[model samples]
Structures are given as C-alpha cells and as structure tokens.
Target: MTETLLPTATGGEARSAAWTALRRVRGHVALTLLVLTVGTVIGLVGPWLLGRIVDLVIDGRTDELLPVVLGLIGVAIGQAIGQTVGTAMVAHVGQTVIAGVREKAIRQVLRVSEGRIERAGSGDVMSRVSGDVETVNEAVSGVLPTLLDAALTIVLTAVTLAILDWRFALAGLAAVPFQVVATRWYLRNAVPVIRAERVAEGSRAQQLLDSINGANTVRALRLESDHLAKVTAASDKARQLSIRMAAVQRRFFGKLNYGEFVGLALILVVGFYLVRGDLVTIGAASAAALYFHRLFDQFNVVLGTFDTAQSATAAFARLIGVAEMATPDLRDGGETDSRSGRGTDGSVSLRDVRFSYGADQHTVIDGVDLDVQDGEHVAVVGTSGAGKTTLVKLVAGLLPPEQGQIVLGGHDLAAGASGSGHRCVLVSQEVHVFADTVLGNLRLSGEHTSETQARSALDAVGASGWLSTLPDGLDTVLGRGGHSLTPTQSQQLALARLVLADPPIAILDEATADAGSAGAKTLEAAAEKAIAGRTAFIVAHRLTQAARADRVILLEDGRIVESGTHDELVDANGSRYAQLWAAWSTHR
Candidate 1:
C-alpha cells in the first residue's frame, strides 16, 4: 500500500470561494449596477406616464391628451434605450465573471493533489468543467439582474399603489402570504428532487463516458446490452427525478398564478365598491387598476428571481466544493535548490520506511530499509501480492512512507520537495503516451533541450529507427486517439525520454514488459548504456535483466527474503531467484 496524498491548493470554505470569485470583477459589477439603476428608472417612467394619462382623462383635460401622449412615447423610447444599455452592461459583466470562474476552476484543477485527481475520476472533472460551470453562467448573468429589478419594482409599485388608495393597495397585497406559503411548500419538496436529478445526471454521464472509453472491452466481452441496461437504469432515475422537479415547479408557479387571479379580482371588487361610495375618483380607480397589474407583475418577477437564486445557490455550492479542495505542499520560495541542479550522484536511501493505503489498512512497507549506491544496479524480485510496487513507489518518491524518510543525494524528500525528486525518474510497464510530439514528450523532462540533444537521446535508445520513419520525424504528433505507436515502440520511446531526463537515480518497474524478450533485450542494453555510472533499481520481469544487475533482492509478503548478487542467488540451488531463473529459462 503506497501512502498517497491528494493534490490541493490553499483554500477556505465555499463562502470564501464566492467572495473570491466576486472580487475578481467588482469594478464591472459596479458599472452593471449603475446601468441597471438607470434601466429601472426608465422602466418605472412608462407606468407612471400611463397613470398620469388616466388622471388627465378623468379630470376632463382633453386639451392635455396630445402632449401627455407624446410625453409617454418619449418615456417609452428612453426606457427602450436604457433597457438595451443595461442588458449589454450586465451581459459584459456576466461574461467577465464567467471568464474568471473558468480560469479559477482550471487553476484549481492543476493545483489539486495528483492522488485526489486519480481518485475523483475523469468523469466528475469533465462534468464540473463542462456541465456544472455552464449552470453558473446563467446564474451569474440573469439571476442578479432579475433580482435587482424585482426588488426595485416591488418598492416603487407598492408606493404608487398606496398613493392610489391605501385600502385597495392593502387588498392587492392580501394574496402574497398564500403565494409565499405555496412557494415554500414547493421549494421544500423540490430542492431535494432537483439536487437528486443533478447527481443522477452526473453519474449517468460519468458511466456513459466510461462505457464509451472502454467500448472495445464491452464489445469483446459481449456486454453491450448489459452496459446499455446500466446506463438506461441511471437515465431512468435521472428522468424520474427531473419529472419530480418539473412537477414541483409547475405546482409552485400554478399557485402563484392562482394568487395573481385572486388578487386581481379583489382589486376590481374593492375598486368598484370604493367608486360607488365616492371614496376614490374614476381616474384614481383606473390608475390603481393599472398599478395593481404592475405590482403583481413585479411580484411575480421577484418570486421568479428568488427561484433562480435558489438554483444558482446550488450551483455555487458545487463550485465552492471544487474550490475548497486542499492544496498540495509544494516547495516554497527560497526553500528548494533550483530545479536547474545537475545532480549526477545517484545514492538513494530509504530508512525505516512504512506505508499503508489507509489508517485501518495493514502496512505494506513495514520498517523497510533499502539503499542503492552510485553506479550500483539492483533488482527487486517479489512473488504476487508482495509489496513490490509499493516499495518501488516509496523509493521513487511517487509516495511518501508513513514513517521514516527517503533521501536522494542526502536531500530529504519533504512535503514541499516531494516531487523535487522528479529529477529521479521512474519508468514502468504502464506507459502513458501523452498527446504530443516525440520531441515534445522527451522535452517534458527538460523543455529547453535542443534538437541535437533530442536526436542523441532517441538514437541511444534504438528508437531513432522508427522515430526517423515518422512523417515529421521528431515533430510527428502521437497519441491523440488517431496517430499511434506500437506498445514496444512506445516503451522504447519512454526509455528514450529517460535517457534525455538523465536522472541520477532511475527506477525501472517492469519497463520493458510490453516489448517481450528480444525487444526487452534491446531496451535492457540501451538502459545499461544510459544508466551507466548512475544508481538504478530494476523491478525485472525477464531473467536476463536481473542477471545483469550488480545485486538482486528477493522479497516475499512484506519482507526481504534474500539479498545477494544474481549469480550468488542462482548458485543457492533451491533459492527463489534460482527457481525464478529456471522457470524463465524453461519458458524461453
């Protein structure tokens, strides 16, 4: 069990995340608010003019109709202009906020621990990157504007309605409590359902992506129907959850509509009785009626705005969850030797090392001690279920032992300097051919390598032959789901990179397994040449590579069963290495 920690960045809670995101475009936000205020003023003017027109008509001021009508038209035109500017301003602000969010999310992804990324799965990351972030775009843009407008409209309309007739205004607001209660009921039931729908949707997308990436395996095993069944079940669950969400929203809005109708009827009845009693003039009644519609219209907008806010809150929560991921303990400024160090001494040591997958898990490398001196090549052979890979990972700095320490060239690999040992390279049978050029891949070790250095590195690994045959030579693109190199050729290319990386210490964990005996022999010879005068540890698969080691280590369970030269181990008649060699000889 290799003790792995997640990659994360320095961060606080989701609340902090929202604040951090907002601070990115505070200036733009201020501008947007200013524009929205102007728009609100313009929007209110149109209704005010209508009310004034009614007042004029009722007062028998027929002479004032044309000017009043013209004034109303001018207000309408100004409202339209203001609305356009406000919308554009808000949109620009939203885009800037969205851009900031996208950049931050990507930065977070990069800062998170490598171990966490592996555990989280690619699908979740993809969902966050594409789907989850998309939800926030609408939240950032439309929700804020609508909420502002709703708040202002509610305030202005309530004031105007009260001026018309306090009795009628109070009557108009009577249905608000009913709408509020209904909305609360809907939200209480709907929030869980909406959240469930989002989770199910994410899971379905993840599983579908997994299936697509492994389509060859599914088809080979004739499990297409089984895969489809699993996906269909997830999709059905998502659909059911969505249906529940839709049902709740419909019921919530339906109740809102009912409240609107009830409120309007009350207004009409109350206005008519007030008119009969001569308590309010006809013009005030007509103006009040118009004001009633405006009040309710803005009330609906306010309610809808709240609904959007709820949805945005959920999305913000998810984004904040991502932002809250722990940061890695990378080396601080002035704490690390420059990455430019050209260390050539490969003395590697692990003292009293211990590691476990979890707190409750059994220790894999229990108090293990290992050392490889400069120019010494060692082979660690282990039976199945033994902690071979775990031990190798500890030595390679891919994982830190729970207890004890690893030292390369007397430098302790601490939290900040954990991957500082990247100068100590590890090549495993599981090769990752990145979507890049051959030269690009090699240059990952040292980005400033010249073409001469790259060509020399390729030639040293016997990969120069196939590499030269490529259409673009070292510039040929590879591993983009289109271009490909054979497993053997890819393994050779990996070795070529190791040659270029030129680490003082190298850990080869079955690096040539994909290449078979002949190809392994070629790679083994190349590795010997490249690793000369540097400390190396080979987790050998083929007996030939082990036979070439300066020493061989036999491990069983979590203990070193034997340690001696390969020739010495072979001569020990019934030794594990002797038996392993015999088996390999027979297979060959």
Candidate 2:
C-alpha cells in the first residue's frame, strides 16, 4: 500500500467552496458592501473639500472655508461609523462561515476510516484542524476587513480624481504598470516559497507529534536526545523556509514601494502641468494630487496583503478538502445465516484473509480461514508479532483484508456496514475518556441515548460500584481535567460504551491488557458482560482472556496454527498452546 497525505482542494473546487459559503451569507455580504461603499463615498468628499477650500482661499472667499472644515469633520465621523459597522458585520460573517467549515471538517475526519488515518499521519490532519484553520481565521477576521476597505477606497478615489479632471485619473494610472509588474514577479516567486513553507511546517508538526506522543517511550529507551534532535532539525528547517518566504515578501514590498513613489511623482507632475497649462485651477490640481496620494495608501493595503491572502487561500483549500472527504454511512446489519451450524445472526467468517502494511513489507496476515458462530466468544492467542490485532481489526471492519472475503453477520465486509441495527465495533486497551460528563461520554455511543440508557450501560459493564462514588454521579465530568479514572475504571467505562453501542459483532483487541494483573479478572468479567450475546473476537494478549473463551485459536506468522477449545489445546502435549500454558501455569 502506498501512503499519501490528505488532499487539498483544486482551484475549481476551492472557488466553488467559496461561492457556496458566500451565497449562504449573501444577505450579510450585501449589507456589508453597501455600508462600506457609503463609507468610501463619504471619505472621498474629504479631499475634494480640501481642494474646494484651497480654491476658495485663493479667490478670497473666506466665508466658504467654514463649511468645508465642517464638511471634513462630518465626513470623518460618518466614514468612521460606517467603516466600523461594516467591518464588524463582514468579520462576523467570515467567522460564521469559517466555524461551519471547521466543524464539518472535524466531523468528516472523525468519520474517516482508521486505516486511512493510519496511512496518513495524525499530525498532518491535526495541524490542518488547528494551524491551518487559525491561518484562515486570521486572514478572514484581521486582513479581510482592511483589504475590503482599501479596495473600496481605491475605487472611489480613482472616480473622485476623474471627476476633478480626466487628466488626473490618467496620471494616477502611471503606477499600474509598476504595480502590475511587481505583482506578477511576486506571484511568480513568492507563491512557490509560501507553498514550500506550508509543506515544511506540516513536516515539523508531524515530527513534533511524534516526539510528544512518544515521550514516555523515548525516555524509557533513553533516546530522548535523539528524538529531540530530530524535532529541532525539523523545526529549524521550517524556520529557514519561513525566513526565505519573508525575504521574498520583503522584496515584493520593495517593488511596490517603487510603484508608490513613481505613482505619486507622476500624479504631481501631471497636476503641475495641468495647472501651468491653464487646463485646471490650482485647487483642482491640488485635490487631484491628494486623491492620488490617498489612492496609493489604499493600494498599498490591498497589494501588501497578497501573501496573507494566498496563505489563507491555501489553508481554506485544505480545510474544504477535508470537509468534503467522502464517508460511508455505516450501520451494523446482519442477515440469517446457518453456515456455522447455527441459524443465527452475527456469525463471522473469514476466507484466505491476507494483509500487508506496504508493498515492500512482508505479508502481515497470510491466508487465514476462520468461522465464528453467532454469540460465540472466540479468543485468538499469539506471541508479540503474530498479527492477532490485525485479524481482529479485519473482522471489525476497521481494516480491509488484502485478498480475501470477510463476512460479518452474513453481510460481505466490502458491502457498507449498513443495516437496521447497530454496527460492528472495535475496542482496544487504549481507551478514550472524552472531556465530558459521564452521561455525555456514554451518549457518544449514539447521540440519542437517554440518561437512563447510560445508567443501564454502566450497570451492565460492572461500573455501577464506582458510579455512586462520583461527586455528581452521572453528571460528573470525566477525562483530562475532571475525574481521573484508574486503568481498570477506564476500561470499565469503555465497556459501558460498548454496551451502549450494542453492536451485533464486537472485536476486543487486548481490551483488558491495560488493567494490569490486579484488575485483570475484574476487567475480563466486565468485557464478558459487554460482549454477551454478540459474536466477539478477542485478541488475547494475556492467556487469562483465552481461558474464558468458548474456543481458542493459536496464530503464528499470520496463520492459524491450532483451533480448538482452550482446554483441548492445553491437553495436547508439546503443542504451542500447551507449551505456552505450561509456562503460564509454572509462573502462576
């Protein structure tokens, strides 16, 4: 299998995403544009009033000066009010759209198959949720308002210059060629650098996740320095890329600065010529020059944010891609089957199942045939590298077999896990206690689960003994900052979730391994209750789990070496299971 990163939206798809978002907020967008346009119009009056005041002063019409000063004051106040309201509205709309996008992306990601997540590092997906969303949010909230204002102001200023004299507008056009060239050069150079920086940042994030997530292992193995060195190197590489991007950005700005200088100088030259040629009054020429200068400032705002806009665009594309990722609507379903000598649902059968991590890697699961009767508690026993967990995942539909058929509940595994009932579920020793109330976490099994149902699940999982000890009972918050659960307690909680989900088929891959020796039996009993009446596939890390199963299978090198009752396997002299049990018994 070839591993690849999650996709980014193509240009067309990004545009469609943007259009769809904008259309959803079309009402707010219209109001924002209207208010901003009003502000721009009011602002344009200021320079024209300054020109009128100059002309009046030159003509000795001193009385007209008061009105012009008052007009300037009014213009300032009106523009300020309009701009403030318009910008806030636009920002709110932007935030609303971004929040929806983030939520959708997160929801889709949570639905994505575990195998795909394993192929694409979790760090890459997490960074998009946090870092990329932040980037887009910053652009939308911070940069967008200013860019809109500048652009609107520039357009109105150009029109005002034209009203004063067509020549003034023509003169202002002098900067266009310079700005155009600068923009072209920047896009040609800076865009590639920005894209490279995003990739390098993603790599750095992945390395950071690796270092942090494996901190305990790194310390235990005494390779902390090695991991730290790799993290530092990745961070430094990203930093270097950022610096290179900044250099390109600065050079782009320098070229814009040249355009600004050239633009202002030409406007002045044109104003001076018009004044000398008697084509316009001194005040008109002065006002035209002032308008061009104001235009340049707004032009700078619009053009200078080019890189930030590009960054946001890139981030938005990634977010939209994630949000739009296809997900199967899976529901557990089963049909009647008597292949296992029992006319019951939830019987699982695997035929020549094979799997490998990568093309270059050895086959992790060789041809393995197995049949699990409905409600049968089957345990798979294996040494450390025996691919037992992989088999369990395959049975639970978490992974696809490379070249075999897996039928769950008489339904082909390739057929979507859709039925009228709860679907197959996989639970591992690594349990998750989300930061939520006890009832809230339980309801994760199904959002519609009632408080009564949650209580019942806890009771079913043998967690009722501890439930009464919580400060707020079912309302008590659990996980990170709230109530801390012991390993056994956590496993019990996980079992409660399993009961709430009530899948027809359950795969428990070392579900009790983390409880340690002291609580092993307690967790094992809870697991029994959780999977009662369901076809269960247990990846038995400890022999104790195997001892309780209806039947036990020994796996070696991805093949089933022996399949029989645990007692039968133990009775067979010199067999692998017998040898393992003999050693286990000696230790006991």
Q: Which candidate is the best by TM-score?
A: 2
Residue pairs of candidate 2 with colliding backbone atoms: 332-423
Report how far off residue 448 is in candidate 2 (Å).
2.7
Cα deviation at 547, candidate 1, in Å, is 4.8
Worst 10 residues of 2 by lDDT: 335-344
lDDT of 2 at 479: 88
Q: Which residues of candidate 2, in runs, are more than 4 Å off?
A: 1-3, 216-225, 276-279, 331-345, 415-422, 516-518, 572-574
RMSD (Å) per prediction: 5.6, 3.7
lDDT of 1 by residue, 1-588 (tens): 012222222234555766766688788778877776776776666665676777777788989889878977887887677767777777677667667666767667765644355556666667666776777678666776667666766777777778768888788888788788887887788777766665676678777887899999999999999999989998899899877777777777778888888888888888899889999766667777777788788777777666556656665565556655544443322232233354755777878888777678887878778887877998988877678877887776666668998777766765545444444678889888889888888887678988888898888877788877899988888997536988778877788788777777788898877876677778787777767766888888776888889999987767788889988999997898899888889988
lDDT of 1 at 408: 74
- lDDT of model number 1: 0.74
